[model samples]
Target chain A: MYKKPSSRRIKKFYAPLNLIPILDSVFILIFYLLMSAQFVKIFEIGSDLPIMADSPPSNMKDALNLTVDVDQDEIRIFTTVNETLYKTIPLNSDGTFDLTTLTGILATLKGRYPKENAIVIRPSSLIKYDDLVKILDSVREKGSGKSSIDLFAQIIFGNLGG
Target chain B: MGLRFRGRRQKKQEFYLELNSLMDVLFILLVFLIKNYSANNLNIPENIVLPHSVASKQINQAIVIQLTSEKKLYLNDILVADLEKDKELADGNIITALYDKMVDAKQNIKYKAKTLGDIHGTDEIVNLLMDKNLPYKYIRKIMFTSQTAGFKEFKFIVEGKE
Candidate 1:
């Protein structure tokens, strides 16, 4: 109030810094990254190699190696040695497999052919990668709600996964 | 004196924010990201995406083969074969170059199982870091090449979620 109206008076008018806008953007960016980042995860799903150095055929000719292949539409389960079709799990309306159903079928297979431990999963060239893992999960773990059942823990690749 | 009093009143009118809580939240997020960032470095490309699964095991040390959605094949981070083009060879089912690379790697470590006491049981295993959606054929071809090279086991690197 006591300052003179001189040419240097402009220097006295200090513009307050508005960091709120910058802080808002930075907070938004941090939240976005936080929401997207998957923490404490990354696992290995090992498949027993069918063609090991001493790879020997199963003695039980009736029971065959399981092979699961997927196309753009549905996932087909088969036996590799004889190329026999066993089951087909179709994709849902949203282009997703009924994983629960697949898990049930796999559980039943385990119950019948308890000796057969290896399973081969081969997704088609046109399928999305995320969906393929989901299928693997279904094969590896079963039983929802309260209890968990492990199935076909010894998964392996077909002589040729393709 | 009046001018000084007016300046003090202006300072009193300006509202201040408590940034301690904000800093705390940001620090927590930063620590979380840094902790789990290693999972993203499984020789997978930035554009590539793996599948998420709870059924996972700890990854072991072995030869790493990464197949991206682009059909790009990487053996231990070195670009080896493009599955899009190198689908077949006159000699056998696998790509000639991949087979050769695998063989070279095999010869180096195969005998180590005997010498080093098989600390990781790595002499016969090949770790596969495949895109979830890649076709089964690529996997088969790679498996063939790996088998020809003498690897008898495979472990798939999958994104783990608990």
Candidate 2:
């Protein structure tokens, strides 16, 4: 006669859970995230009036564009040599300056020191921001097509009064 | 192994492992996980660097226009823009050059408009990269000039220290 096992007996041959596949999937996900993380850099600039931080700065070696102040009421345009000023122009109320033959003077200076890069525009602190923009716009517009260089590169926008 | 008669008897006994119900629960759980996976933890990088409050939005490999507090201009780290000596502003010729480049960009957009629906939109966005110490006047002038030349939208670049 054949012997039968007890009904309460448990089977030990059940299938084991395979964890290698799940772990492999997790690792792949991690690698994907790390590869996609992009590194970025950022920079900032502000709009309020500015103050010169340089103290006892030497005169610019290049020909400097300079804005002159005649009185509190008017601003002029000129270029500087050492500390001396020459060839100044009065600014209009609209900040659209009438060079008053100053362009010829500037042209002469440009010819004299053709390689100079320094150009300064000194306006009073009281000058409106809009006016300042207009003045800069006019300066930028001056060199459109004729000469390769249309404006000076190193501008010193300042006011002796400020 | 069991003998053939016992194996035949076992096969005819109507096996009830009840794996169908367990599979149904697992399938529901899997669907739930798949649905919520994106919302839970995806698209965020491991290193989260926050930019300055006013920093421009993110972009990929953009044209950088940098301005210094002293009114120095750098176009894409190249010394394309410079300040005029005796002038507190940028050289007019450089501005014209930039304007011409922008005009070309606009014309290119116009030419591509037939094939691309948003050609103008693509060119309107430029990355304005400014140093932290750069004055607001320079940026403002750039914005004004770019707008006049038809680049209305801008993305400001900021470098975060943290």
DockQ of predicted model 1: 0.32
Per-residue alpha-carbon lDDT of candidate 1 for residues B76-115, written as tens digits (9 for 90 to 100): 8898877677545423577777778888877667677667
Candidate 1 stretches with Cα past 4 Å from truth are A1-40, A51-71, A77-86, A112-116, A120-128, A143-146, A159-162, B1-42, B84-92, B111-121
All models, DockQ values? 0.32, 0.07
Enumerate residue pairs that collide in model 1.
Answer: A42-B160, A47-A155, A48-A155, A48-A156, A129-B132, A129-B133, A161-B140, A162-B136, A162-B137
True contacts kept of each: 0.67, 0.14
Candidate 2 per-residue lDDT, tens place, B67-151, comes to 5444455554545545544253452312654566667766776667666665324556556654444434455566656666766
Task: Superpose all Cα atoms of candidate 1 onto the true structure and report the RMSD in Å to 1 decimal.
Answer: 10.5
Q: What value does the TM-score of chain B take for model 2?
A: 0.48
Residue A82's lDDT within candidate 2 is 54
lDDT of 2 by residue, A1-162 (tens): 877986657556656455456545655654554454334443332221223466734645553545444333454555555546574465566655564344555556666866664555555433443344334434422443444344343334343222
Model 2, CA-based lDDT? 0.47
